[model samples]
Target chain A: MANAVLTVRGIVRSFGAFRAVDEVNLDIIEGEIHALIGPNGAGKTTFFNLLTGSLPLTEGEIRLRGEVISGLPMDEIARRGIVRSYQISSIFPDFTALANVRFALQRKRGANFDFWRSERSLESLHGRALELLDELGLVEWADVRAGDLPYGRKRALEIATTLALDPQILLLDEPTSGMGREDIGRVVDLIRKVSKGRTVVMVEHNLSVVEGLCNNVTVLARGRVIASGSYKDVASNEKVVEAYLGAAHA
Target chain B: MAGTAFLKTTRTAGVSQSQFLGFTKARAIFFLLFAALIAVGPQFLYPIFLIKVYCFIIFACGYNLLLGYTGLMSFGHAAFFGMGAYLCGYAATQWGLPFELSVLAGTVIAAAMGLVFGWIAIRRTGLYFAMITLALAQMVYFIAMQAPFTGGENGIQSIPRGTVLGFIDLSSNTTLYWVISVIVLAAVAFYNRIIHSPFGQVLRAVRNNPERAKSLGYNVDRFKLAAFTISAAMAGFAASLKTITFGIATLTDVSYVISTEVVLINLVGGIGTIFGPVVGSFFILSLEHFLAPYGPWVLLIQGIVFTVFVLLFRQGIVGELQKRFRTHL
Candidate 1:
């Protein structure tokens, strides 16, 4: 197997007695689209939050490139090359698409503390931001406010902004959750294109996108990993099918 | 969506594309006109009145740096303002320091206060943040009322104007007026530079979506604290100037009423717009000047005006003009 780019070892998260994420372990390989799928309320989002340092872990540790990052703050974690996209399509809605990307680029360039320099003087960042926008096919919407973009386009912009961070690992929570079929296809293609040189860990609900795009799959049920393997191996696993059917019946 | 619509309409309206040191041409013109007025102001208006307006203008601008651009509503700004006044007053009167040194001391103290208050306040957000700041300010107010150096209830009074540098006597009101004008204009210009800089972009991003900013790897708390400290320092500068101009520091300066008054001024002048605070300061101060003869009726008139502005002019004078003319100022 290829070396794991991100390692989550025996991670546990609890809310009082609930145990939202219980003793979960994950090893995401470098340059692979790793799918983390589970039934509803399987603690997928909680696990994602723990990995990204948005929520403190109840137990266990997460490491990126062999360095422990389990308890660092969200921004600190992000600076170490782990960036994420929200399930709700988070973007700076008031800013223009270009400005949103430019903000990301500014952070990537470590210019967040540059109070004395005019924003206009950062022409290199503008060019790079535009290139990123164009890469996402959002060049036409460059000047448009993100809040005014349609839902799918907003999702695309979120990914573009995330891309501007030049992250080593992209943790996307439901990147194509609320999209139409065409939009889903477009995002799937976009994800495929962008995930070429980086590791991707996505908690996705759409089974087909997972089957088509993901090289490996991890099936989670009741906050436990039921199955982990290639898509074909995991999809045909008895426990994985039972968990999905059981969730549907319940 | 509403914010996007508002921005679209305003941005499309003849907004000047050219900027000199972050001031759009319209804003530059506004500043030029303001300077001209300052140069000729004392002949037509009371020098003290103009100084009062200038002080509040600085205060409001500093307040707007936090509440307007950063979307952090602080209800304890008077703590910094009053502390500046009291500290500068005490330094000048007790230690017999020069005007410049006292003002510098006051600004440093205010920045320290901002650091402590901002560190605590930023731990919470929205109403909780506002309440915490308000609580902190009240604590400072009580401290001021008891602290011996602050002169207790009477405050530090009869602070000397002192000589600027080693020679330029500021006993002359006109001389003091010119000094204040230069300081205030420079401060405003500096503020303009800040809001147009890369840091300001990050601040706006934090205001727009803090979580998103964090995910982008910007230390949101640190940025917020920096802005808070700068704002507090500016507020302190204004208060020191006020103390120097009036030669006194009083309880009224630090009261919660002053805090609310600054908020109202920012709101009436357009909270986020660059020139809104200046316009609001002038408008409110003018109202006060005109209504001063009416006794307690002045408060009633001010309330009525505030109500009318809130209902009819949501953006304030400069904001409305910006909307109409498509210019930032």
Candidate 2:
């Protein structure tokens, strides 16, 4: 059995009077695709924000491979292997798709500090950058400017850049959000393919994406964990349905 | 790959499979033409005027690194420019420091100041960031006004040019012009290297989407601060060069007025393009020199030019040219 790679213990984040995330706990087993599913306005993203250190934790701690990482800075957390993709497409729009992936590749090896050396000097990275791009089926879009890319290709490019870090744990926020049927299928397969060697904790609204790709599902509603199990278990959970449809409909 | 060869001729980061390494056949030709011009310019053009243009160009390019590449708008850039002048002038005039060491003192000190202010100012972003820089510059301006060594309102005057390497004579106007122009061209080349370096790529990424850069495991503020420090150091370098070339440091150079002038130069040229500051600095400085006889009407005419350019030619000279020609400038 795979061990827990990341453990969340009683994490809470509040905005003044409002509790955006409240005492949520989960164990992300190594190599398992874990889904954090919640309806709109639920704290799925806020929780992801806390986990990635994008937002400061109000209480409790998170352990990455058993070491406390809750108080680390965002980039420090990312460097320690918790890289995230934003819910909104967060690609460097002006850079070429190749450069976008190249940016992450350079950061991994701490070469972004090379101000005196020409970027061309890092030709050593091109093969690996192209390989990462090709991994996400982005090889053809490699030279295209990232902003000018179509929506589907742009999302793929973002994932390509994310994967360039070769992250130990990947946090994908709504990876297939706002996509058509065809694009969704491609992205789901892409996610499944990349999730082979590492744990993926994704905040997903699309239940089919969760069912087909995720092994463990944790349902969040009103900032609390309402359900935690396999997809089939969470789908029929009474509290989960009530949170989605409200009291009358459920 | 055969078809992509044509893209290699272009300068912009379009369709080209390789990174912009800041040089091409056209750029080589351009630099050669610049060298030829600087060599011959003193023969026909006013040497002082040419030297001033060079100084402003270097200053503007440095400012552009922060403003254009990093999207850091510092409205108080004159603090560095003026500080460079003040320190270089004092170091050379009183301390008997070599001209080169004096220049180093100016640039290094200004960069150190940049590190401190950037640490504080980067805590805020956008207009607030600009405001902090401006406030810091204002504090500098007041310090210059009250400081005894700076000579207050009268300013430091008649600073010795103190020969290159202590062996070369700089008293001759033509000799001084050649020396300043060469340094300016080298600085321009250095600026090009900076914008095309791996660090440059990361700065642009930070500009494009800082949060995304952070999510990619970069400490975003460090890049911003580093760019700020580089910009400040370069601004100081330009001012030190100017103080020696002109033989004076004054209140006007470090004042808020000069800060706005550098912005105008960048906006009028092309903010991010390779030679935008060069073209913009030449045009604005020439225009001011052209209108010098008009006395107080200089600001009014300059304002008109700025307004017309902003309205009709928003991309400035080089920016529009780069886009229209699909060429990297």
Candidate 2 per-residue lDDT over residues B1-329, each given as its tens digit: 32233333332333234332356555555667777888888788799999999999999999999999999999999999999899999999999888899999889978998898899999899999999999999999999999999999989999998889888888898888888987988888888888878889889999999999988889999999999999999889999999998889999988999899999999999888778898899899998998899998999989998998899988899888888877777
Residue ranges of candidate 2 with Cα displaced over 4 Å: B1-22
Residues A112-231 of candidate 2 have per-residue lDDT tens digits of 777887667655666777777676666667678899998878888888889999899999999887778987887888788888898899998888888999999999998999999999
Report the lDDT of model 1 for residue B171. Answer: 92
The alpha-carbon deviation from the true structure for residue A215 of candidate 1, after best TM-score superposition, in angstroms, is 1.1
True contacts kept of each: 0.61, 0.63
lDDT of 1 by residue, B1-329 (tens): 22333333333212235776568888899988888988999999999999999999999998998998999999999999999999999899888899999999889899999999999999999999999999999999999898888888888888999988979899999999998999889888888878877888888889999988988888999999999999999989999999999999999889998898898899888988888888899988898898888888978887887898889998888888988997667
For each candidate in the order shown, give its overall lDDT on alpha carbons.
0.87, 0.87
Which number leads on DockQ? 2
Q: What are the runs in model 1 whose C-alpha is more than 4 Å off? A: A180-182, A247-250, B1-17, B310-312
The candidate that achieves the highest TM-score relative to the unseen native structure = 2
Docking verdict class for candidate 2: medium
* Residue lDDT tens for model 1, A1-250: 2598888899999899989899998899999999999999989888889988899999999998899999999999999999999999899998888788878888877766677776665555666676777777777787798899988889989999999887899989999988899878988998898898998999999999999999999988989999999999998888888888864543
